[model samples]
Target: MPNQPKTPVKGFRIPVDLYDAALAKAQSEGRTLTDVVREALHRYIDAD
Candidate 1:
């Protein structure tokens, strides 16, 4: 069987200063902060 990630999710908060600019940018783009952060993290960690 293939390994799989655990589910039934949990979450934590980022320090406001860590991504405050990104949150503001997300608001300007009419995106939810969560959506913006999720996309950013996806690209970031997936990068070679």
Candidate 2:
């Protein structure tokens, strides 16, 4: 449904190497990996 509030989701799988890379990038930016993922999701939705 449109305008539905986002709820937490878990257990989405990625390749181990990609996950590690994202974690490193997030750490270098001084943000939790969750925060980085959330921001990316928001930007993607906003752009659509």
Candidate 3:
């Protein structure tokens, strides 16, 4: 079979509690919230 193209990734907004947790984790990790979230997502996608 031919290789299929990857679809564009979609983003969703965080709820308050999760957003706060991510912000806290980001601060403690010395990273920006965006970086923290991106890193988390990268891990999630790579897990499988």
Most accurate candidate by lDDT = 2
Q: How far is 15's C-alpha from truth in model 1 (Å)? A: 4.5
lDDT of 2 by residue, 1-48 (tens): 359788777768899999999999999988889888888889999996
Candidate 1 positional error at 20, Å: 3.2
Model 1: per-residue lDDT, tens digit, 1-48? 139665455588778786788778888998887677568789999996
lDDT of 3: 0.79
- Flag clash pairs in model 1: none
Every model's TM-score: 0.49, 0.73, 0.58
Best-to-worst order by TM-score is 2, 3, 1
What is the TM-score (0 to 1) of candidate 2? 0.73
Best-first order by lDDT: 2, 3, 1
Cα-based lDDT at residue 18, candidate 1: 66
Q: Give lDDT per model, in order.
A: 0.76, 0.87, 0.79
lDDT of 3 at 13: 76
- 34 Cα displacement, candidate 3 (Å): 0.8
**Which candidate model has the greater lDDT, 1 or 3?**
3
Candidate 3: the clashing residue pairs are none
Best by TM-score: 2
